[model samples]
Target: MLKKRMINLLATGFYTGLSPIAPGTVGTIAALIFALVWIQKYTISFAFILIFVCGGTLISQWAEELYGVKDASQIVIDEWAGFFIAVFGLGVDKFLLAFILFRIFDIFKPPPIRNLQKFHGGIGIMLDDILAGLMANILLRVALNFF
Candidate 1:
């Protein structure tokens, strides 16, 4: 069906998230590669970036239905969007640090990140990762001040 195809294309990170182990990590890695190749190289406007971030919510929610499970591991677009949030305007130099921080927050789900999961559907799925990215970005920004 078209929905299955759509989920396969978008939610799976073009099937990159379909990696047998650590799919979320794979998705994040895909996002990191994208940031280094395209996002960091080109200076897109905040408005355009915001469009992707906001659009993720819709696609993620739609994809959730096809998976039949809340925040399924197969749905890694959230990871992609979160990594985008983590790096946003940061340089490639900060990639490692930002990635570690984002991964920690995403994996551990401290505070509001865990709380966010309570919401229904895609809002629930994407919001926590978005928050994790924000948290990681904040930490990266702080570290940038010192280093």
Candidate 2:
């Protein structure tokens, strides 16, 4: 059972959902690594963004069922998807800014973000992050332009 659980968590990206230290941090790092590696060759960031969004949705739903829990902390695919949105194509050179923005959006869940979470199944799991990501992107864009 323990081995199986570990496999499940690893498959879900290190049980990042259950991380006490910094779940978002773990998820963001995972997402960044993916972006750097998989998206390195792609000139268009939009393609990467779409892939993350769609893939994250399917993976999140699978993790939800595997974990037999809704919004399980061990499932960080949502975080991965969310982080991508927050940092994708913002032209922010600084990693610190991306980190801050991703965390803020994940935690705050402003407006439609909170509303999106009310959705059922994998879509609900994914949509909330999408909203949060969009909010973070908008905020980050504004901040970058200002500063």
Candidate 3:
């Protein structure tokens, strides 16, 4: 019971992911708070991001089995990992822009992002969002160059 409780708390982004509507968005917003307050520089952010991605993946696998559903909406540690990747090295000024781009890419699941759903369990859940973050990062880079 304790283990399940811990898993639920961590995997659900402190229960923000339980929202019936736009839960992923809520999780990402929580991630934005983490990025703004905790992420300071590229080196530190990399470490934190890696830890989060790994932790999310591990817990998500457990969560899937526990929930009897693959990529259950309640598993939102993936969102935090994705958002961290989206804002990586981009600094606070770009946070809002990254958030918008990431949300679009995630929700739309364009191309490979959608395809990543083919994987089962944690990898599937995490990869799709990771790809969305990658897309957002690439687009932000391009936009920054042009603008």
Candidate 4:
């Protein structure tokens, strides 16, 4: 009942995005969950891109209709996918840093990320997060070096 409605409203990832809490914040936390569970199993690189490609394509389409907007904030499958990218290759365990760095990069949307969003459909929906994830991973690596 309620769960289904929330699913419909969120288009899954979108609902996660629309959280009264910062959408990026929730998305990054979700990412940490994924990282903790998944990194133990497969190569984070493969998993990150795979999740990005699959989740972004399906949910972005759902969100387009659900929000009546091309890329609504509520549609955060993008975030989930993107977060995977951020922490993908690093193999770091500092959950808080991963979350913060990922959120910052996602929010800042620097350069290529901001430009990438101009695309429509899956690519536009998904690319920004991939870039954000990469940026976050780099930051994570740098931070790890210091700490």
Candidate 5:
């Protein structure tokens, strides 16, 4: 029971995923606030993103079993992980841009991003968002160069 609860807590982004509308967006916003407040250095942010990704994978796999749904809506830790990746090493000023771009990529799931969802279990749950974040990060870097 405790183990399930703990997984639930973590997988839900501390319950931000429980939002009735756009749970993924809310969870990403929560992650953004956390990044802005506590993640100051690039190294620390990278480490945290790694942790979120690995931990999110395990937790999401368990969440899928518990919820009896593949990639349950309440499991938003993937979003948290992805959002962290989106803003990886970027300044606070770019956080909003990263968030917007991440959301667009995630929602649209262009090309390979959507294809990742076909994989099963935690990898399937996390890969699409991971690709979206990577896309966002790359775009943000290129956009910054031009502007």
Candidate 6:
């Protein structure tokens, strides 16, 4: 019981995923606040993203079993991981743009990003958002170069 509860907590991004609407966005907002407050260095942010990706995989897989749904909406750890990646190495001033871009990429899942969802289990859950974050990061970098 304790293990399940803990998994639930983490997998749900400390229950931010339990929001009645737009749980993934809520989870991303929680992640953004967390990044703003606690993540000071790019190295630290990268480390957390790695941890979230690896741990998120296991916890998300377990969460799917618990919820009896594949990639359930309540599993928003992926969003947390992705949002962190989207803002990776970006300064505070750029986080809002990163957030917006990440949301767009995540929602639309353009090109290969959408294709990643065909994977099964935890990888399937994590890959799409990971790609979305990477895309957002890349686009943000390009946009910054122009301005």
The C-alpha TM-scores of every prediction are 0.91, 0.79, 0.94, 0.75, 0.95, 0.95
What tens digits encode model 1's per-residue C-alpha lDDT throughout 1-102? 887797678888888878999999988998888777785457535775677777777887888887787887888888988887887778778888888999
TM value for model 6: 0.95
Where does candidate 2 have its weakest 10-residue lDDT segment?
35-44
**Each model's Cα RMSD:** 1.6, 3.4, 1.6, 3.6, 1.4, 1.4
What lDDT does candidate 1 reach at residue 31?
Answer: 82
Pairs in clash, predicted candidate 2? 17-73, 18-73
What stretches of model 5 exceed 4 Å from their correct place? 40-43
lDDT of 6 by residue, 23-83 (tens): 9999999999988877554443566788879999999999988999989998999998898
Q: Between the candidate structures 1 and 3, which one is better when assessed by lDDT?
A: 3
Instruction: Please give the RMSD of candidate 3 to the true structure.
Output: 1.6
lDDT of 3: 0.87
* lDDT tens per residue, model 3, 1-84: 999999999999999999899999999998888677675443336777788888889999998998999899878899888888
Higher-ranked by lDDT: 2 or 4: 2
lDDT, each prediction: 0.83, 0.70, 0.87, 0.70, 0.90, 0.90
lDDT of 4 by residue, 1-147 (tens): 674465454454535566777766775576677668776776667855885668667657755765578777667777777677666665555556766777777888888778987898766777788788778878788877898
Considering TM-score, which of the candidate structures 3 and 5 is the better prediction for this target? Answer: 5
Cα lDDT for residue 79, candidate 6? 94
The CA lDDT at 13 in model 5 is 94
Error of 6 at 122 (Å): 0.9
TM-score, model 1 to reference: 0.91
| Model 2 whole-model lDDT (C-alpha atoms) | 0.70
Pitting candidate 2 against candidate 3, the one with the higher lDDT is 3
